[model samples]
Structures are given as structure tokens and as C-alpha cells.
Target: MIAVCQFGGSNCDRDAVLALRHLGFEAERVWHADGLPAEADGVVLPGGFSYGDYLRAGAMAARAPILREVCDAAERGVPVLGICNGAQVGTETGLVPGAFTTNASARFRCEHVHLRVENAETPWTAGFEPGEVLTLPIAHGEGRFEIAEDTLADLDDDRVLFRYCNEAGAVTDAANPNGSVDGVAGLLGEHEHTAVLMPHPERATLPDLGGTDGRTILRGFASEAEG
Candidate 1:
């Protein structure tokens, strides 16, 4: 079963559960205060305005008791997917490197974006091919990915999952939706199964919703579980 963490202000928890269920995984919304289930084979930190975006987008929720279980699950090599606000929590908790700060425009953005696959072998991108382009929705006020120069240089090639790009797969400043450094859109954490991305894969998972390109990413859970 996949546990989708639902914090106080998490607005996308249901969407995540539905998307996962559509893909044949047993998924359910697990309230943040309730702790994770022992049967959970994967954990999803869904998008939200946790704690009303107080202190920071995901700062408070990142410290909640349930997060410990999430961390332990990741340590055991279970898949942990963090989306949008959850991406902020992932970075805040050091589950991944870099910080997600205010957008370059310092304004909230909501739109579809193209991303080029950087590491097709990682579970998060296994459904895609190297250099392939995927269109996904993004909505956030602070989605910029900032990393120290040395840290950026030290990241393994496989650590990068996807980068913002044009429809044709060209990585350029013009294609950047929120001015993320290097146009990075997603990243793999210390373990290949753990990933965080500032895009709404669930929003793009259902064909009736207009697109299903995001199934490529969410399917990582099934891939990891089967492995």
C-alpha cells in the first residue's frame, strides 16, 4: 500500500491517492498526525500549504512526528516521492540537497511546463527515455532550486531526474518556468528511490484531466515495489 501524507493544509492528498489507485496501487490518505502504516510500501508527500505556508512552505510539516517514519522508510530503501510543497519539505528535512526558495519573479506561478529527462534509469524516470520531454503542471510561490556551487558540482549525474526545457527538449532560460538553477525540475535523493520534484504529477496523471504524462513519474512507486 502507498501512504499519501496529508498535513493540515495539504490540498492535493486526495488527488495523489486517486492517481496512485488508478495505477493499481492500494493508496490512501494518511493524516499527518496518525503516523505511517507498517504496510505502506511507498510514501507520497503531496502538495499543500501546510501550516498555512507559515515559517516557510513546508518547514513546520517537515518536523512533524510522522516525518520520522517517512525518513525511516526511505532509509530502508522504500520509495518516497515528494511533490511541490512536499519538495520543500524534502529539502528542508535533508532528504535531498538544495533549497526551494522564492521564485525569481517572487510571484506565484501556475501553468504547464516541459521537462527533459536527465536520468531515465532512476525509478522516478524509468518510464521515460534520456532527453525525452514531459509536460506537467506546476503551481507554487517558492519553487526555485538553489544549491551551493560546490554542492551542485558534486552531484552525480544520476541525481538529476529532469530539467526544465522547451517542447522540443531544449534546455534554455526561456523554457524555465520558475528560474530554477540549471533549469532543474526534479532530483533523486541519496537513495535512487527517493525523489522530489516541484511539479504536480497527480494533476497530470488522469487522462480525463487533459494529460497523463505524469504517469511516467508516479509509476516509479510500482516499479520500486516490484523490484
Candidate 2:
């Protein structure tokens, strides 16, 4: 079973469960206070404005009681994927590096954007080849990734899972929707089993939504866990 954590303002909890189910995974929303189920084989921190975005987008949810169990699960090598606001929580809890901050435009951005798969080596991105361009939608006001210049330089290429790019897979400033440093869209955690990103993979999983590129990313959980 996969647990989709539901926080106070987690609007995407059900969407995540539905998306995972559509992909043939057993998943359900687990309220933040209820903690994780013992049978949970994977975890997804779905997108949304947790705690009304108080103090910060994901600050409150990152400190929630259930997060302790989530952290423990990640340490045990359980596949964990954090999207959008969840990405912020991941960074807040130190599950992933860097921070998602205010966009350069200082406005909420909601649109489909192209992403270049920077590394296909990690479990979260193994479905695609490096340099593949995927179309994914990003909706956020604080989705710009911020990291120290030196630290960013030290991250292995494999650690940078995805980067905003043009349809041709070129990383250009005009293609960067959020002005994230180096166009980073997603990153791997301390281990390949964990990952965080600002894009809404669940939203892009259904073909009816006009894109199925995200299915590959979510499929990673099933593939990795079953392996």
C-alpha cells in the first residue's frame, strides 16, 4: 500500500491516491494526524497549501507528528516522492537539499512547462532517458529552488533529476518558469529512494489531462518497491 499524506490544506491528497490507483497501485490518503499505515510500502507527499501556507508553504506540515514516521520510512529505504508544496516540506525536514522560495516574478504561476530529464539513473527517473523532455504543469507562488552556489556546484549530475527546459531540451532562461537556479525542477534526496519536485506529477498522470509524462515519475515507486 502507498500512503498519500493528507494535511490540513492538502488539496492534492485525493488526486495523488487516484493517480496512483490509476497506475495500478494500492494507495489511500492517510490524514496527517493519523500517521502512516504499517502496510504502507511507499509514501507520497502530495501538493497543496499545507497549514494555509502559514509561516511558509510547507513549514507547518514538515513539523507535523506524522512526518516523523515519514522520515523514518524514508530512512528505511521506502520510496518517497514529494511534489509541489510537498517539495517545500521535504526541504524543511531535510529530506532533500535546498529550498523552494518565492518566484522571481513574485506571482503565482500556473501553466504547463517543459522539463529536461537530467538524470535517468535514480529510481525516481529511471523510466526516462537522460535529455528526455517532459511536459508537466507547475502551480505555485514559492517554487523557485534556492541553494548555495558552491553547494549546487557540488551536487553530482545524478542528484539533479530534472531541470526546466525548452521543448528542444535546452536549459534557457526564457524556458525557466520559476527562475530556479540552474533551472532545477527536481532533485534526489540523500538516497535514490527519495525525491522532491515542484511539478504536479499526479495532475499530469492522466491522458485526459493532456499529458502522461508524470506517469513515469510516479511509476518509479511501484518499480522500485517491487524490485
Candidate 3:
């Protein structure tokens, strides 16, 4: 079974789980404080204000016992994804290098923004076409991604992934909503088995919500797992 890590302060656990189930996977949520589940095939860190965003969104939650096990899982090449606050945890844990800071706006804002898929090779994005615009929801105070210039170059060369204009089919800085470095919304893991993104794809999993763009991303993950 796949395990979705859920911390006490994580509010989107159920949504993640629901999306996973919709995709026909057997998923379970494990508390962030507990050790990683022994039988997890993959792990997902859903979006939320773990510890109420105290001392940075995921700073305190990074040290939780479950995260240690998650680190172990990541090193073993288990597919893991961190979304929003979960993205912060991924950065803190070194699953994905760099960190997220308060948005240029300095306050939490929730709205739909356009996202262009810059990389279609990752498992989570395999179903998307390069340069596709996906209307996804973003709600966070800290979503800006910062990385060293050298690493940024490496990411570009390796196609680690990037966020682009959801409307113009272009990767322009102006379309960026949170001022993420390089207009990045998602990135591949060092080991190529993990993915972390600030946008909440899970929130857009159903047609009732007015969009199903996220289904492709999640479907890609399951297809890779099956393959």
C-alpha cells in the first residue's frame, strides 16, 4: 500500500488520499509523528500548515519522526511528493535541495493561477504535454523557491522542471504568481524518485471543482508505478 504522511497540522491529507483513491491506488495516511509505515510503496506529503507555520512552514515538522523515515524511504528510491508546506519539508529534509520563503506579497493568498508544464518526463507529469497550461489553485504565504545559482543552472540543464505561463504556453517570469526562482512550481528529486511542488494539484482532481488537470499528474504517477 502507498502511504500518505499526515501531520497533526496538515489540513489536506484527506484530499490527497481521496485523489489517490480516485486513481485506483490503495492509500493510507500515517501520522507525521509516527515512524514511516513499513509497507509503503510511495509517500506523499500533503499541503498544510504543519505546526501552524510556526518558525517557518515546515521547519519544526521536518524533525518529526515520520520525516526521518521518509528520508530513509527517499534514499531508497521510493516515489515521494511534497506539496505546499510539504514542499517546504522536502527542502528541509534535503529530498529536494533549496528552500521556500514568504511570497513577495508577504501574505497568504488563495486563487487559481496558470501553470505551464515545463517537464513532462517526471512520473507525476508524464501525462502532460510539454508547455501545457494547467489552472491550479495556490494558497500559501511562503511559496517562493530559492536555490543557488549553480544549482539553478544544473536544474535547467537536467530539465528538473519549471513553472511557466499557463495561458501563453511560455515560461515567462511575469506569469509567475509567487516569485519562485526561475518560475519553478515543481522539481524532480535528486534520486529521480521524488517530486515536490508548491501548487495543490490534489485540490483540482475532480470535475466538480471545475478542472481535472491534476488527474493527469496523479495518473502519471500510478502509470509509472505499474510499469
Model 1 lDDT per residue over 79-106, tens place: 9999999999999988999999999998
Per-residue lDDT value at 158 in model 1: 81
Compose the digit string of candidate 2's lDDT tens values, residues 107-184: 999999999999988888889998999999999999999998888888776899899999999999999998999999
Candidate 1 collision pairs: none
Task: Give all candidate RMSDs, comma-separated.
Answer: 0.9, 0.9, 1.6
Give the CA lDDT, 0 to 100, for residue 223 in model 2: 74
Per-model clash counts, in order, read 0, 0, 0
lDDT to native, each model = 0.90, 0.91, 0.80
The better-scoring model by TM-score among 1 and 3 is 1
Superior by lDDT: candidate 1 or candidate 3? 1
> What residue pairs clash in candidate 2, if any at all?
none
Candidate 3 on 1-227: residue-level lDDT in tens? Answer: 67788887999889988988987887888886677878887888889989888888898888887888888877877788888889998888788888899887787878877887777777887777877788888888899989998888776444455584648767677777778887888887786678888888888886698687878877766565444
